[model samples]
Target: MTPPPGWYPDPHAPHLQRWWDGAAWTEHRRTPEAPTVPVPTPPGGGTGRARTVALVAAGAVLVAAIVTGAAVLGSGDDGGAETRTAPTATASIAPESPGPTPEESASEPSADDPSVVEDQLNGVTFPLVDGWVRPQYVAQDDVVMTTDGTYDCPGDGTVCRHGLVVSRTVTANDETSPEALAKADISDAAEDAYDRDAIGQKPYGGMESHELVKQGPVAVAGRAGYYVRWRVHTAKGPGGYVQSLVFPSSVGTESPVLVRFVFDAGADGPPLADMDRITKGIRPVGDAGTGGGVGSSIGPTG
Candidate 1:
């Protein structure tokens, strides 16, 4: 029988942690902070379980639909402020984007393209900088890209990379305010990437602490959106930065899309400028340019 959805430490390897399904280990994992409630299993019943697994296997090829392929809001604090009035600025220039077609739900962009992560399911693409790569790593279904290689984590059980970027649609909730969603998701992003390693260790010693660094409205892929960034201090190594950026889809239903980032702070980490470059370079897929498509960059100011 499947046990439940929760994280347990590995006894033989105290530095490692793993996610146990009732009968075995599944891919996604997390760390506990304070005493916490167990993450409920994604709702699936007797009949649905088999079909859900089968469908996921197929979605693996195309990246699935926005509603099915992205994140459901997780339990995080209201870390961002209420929406603020946008500061006046010149809008970026770009060709208008056409809505994505239903057929795109099955299209897979080349991860090694070195220029863009054409997220057909989410109806947007992220630009890749010099040191990043699209990776298929541990618990990587939602991971769109990461820095070139791994480093020794401060804790045990798993390796660490200097940077990572993940994209997910906020499919579970009805909220559409980008500020509210970005604010609510940052804590979860920090915890997921740093605070705990589902497989066994606290990568940066489990986000020792954090402070909001920036928050405000911005334009992503020509859509109005909001972002929240934080400077996180971990229990070990040089800590890093994490951001949650939320924008609406350009295609059907205009669902909210969530893009999360993680970057280590020291010299070995990816330069922070890449974050801004990536944000500015986001474009709707099937656009005219490849290396540096014209996209919007009006985002939160420091």
Candidate 2:
């Protein structure tokens, strides 16, 4: 007998989140699953009360996956405890050994592979899946980061993909301090991103949903930071789940941060586990305690 047409468990594949397409498990269950249907516009533009809740629930799942992944990845050296070392301090303490020469890295598969790689930016280290590139825009409130690219859609050719991870900042004067604002912005963006034109009638089926969940109180250097998750049902054309993480400026030491991941949606494994592994290893540049300035930090806008 065949399994149903939704998510199912696969004894043959451990750590894999399998989806039934009314057929056998496709050989490609290594990535997140995009909705195999299209998003339904609420009839008569009815207040998408359920839709909004679903989107929020989805976000919570995504955030949990990321933070969990980070914790697992960072556990290789320490017994699963996050080290209190700042990326800046670590870099200054020991000059990084030069990585593969451009010629060498080029010879190897591109860093933009489904496998997320740890990247260092401005003394910070974060995970970015291979292939997708950051959106080109000014760093301001609302326009946090954008990434557009293509990825394999299992059982189909590659599909066009674009994701925008936006955010809003809270200055010292704001009622919410950097600490509170960080969580609020992330939680709010997760909510707003799913609201009016949030998904822009993207082709995902109505099965998509969002949930708010705790990610972490992981240490960013000496300061503490939290993580939130967002998961949205997306079009299955490209065959992979696409989601973004928006952290308040305080999370990345007062600079808003957005990270996106897109891979074969039909991938057989649980996406959260894979995403968790990829993101947990990331180490941002500075300490959130710094309370960075707007002129230098990136915010939500474009």
Among these predicted structures, which one has the highest lDDT? 1
Off by over 4 Å in 2: 1-123, 128-179, 186-201, 205-208, 233-270, 284-302
Mind giving the per-residue lDDT tens digits that candidate 2 earns over 1-302?
22223333333543443333343332223323342222355667656786676666655554333223111123545477543211111222122221332122212333444222222211233334433334343222233223444434222232333443332223334342333444555534443333223334433322245543334333332334444444444334322333344343322234434444433333332234434444444444333233212121211111
The weakest ten consecutive residues by lDDT in model 1 span: 85-94
Candidate 1 C-alpha lDDT tens digits along 1-302: 12232333332332333333333333322332232122324456446676566566544432211112111233336664443111111121011111222122223344455466776656567766798876644366567788887877877646788999888778778899999999999999988888886665666667778998878788777778888898888878888889999988775457888999998888898887787889878877666353332234433333
lDDT of 1 at 176: 94
- Alpha-carbon shift of residue 134 in model 1 (angstroms): 1.3
Q: Report the lDDT of model 2 for residue 41.
A: 52
Query: All predictions: root-mean-square deviation over Cα?
Result: 18.7, 25.1
lDDT of 2: 0.35
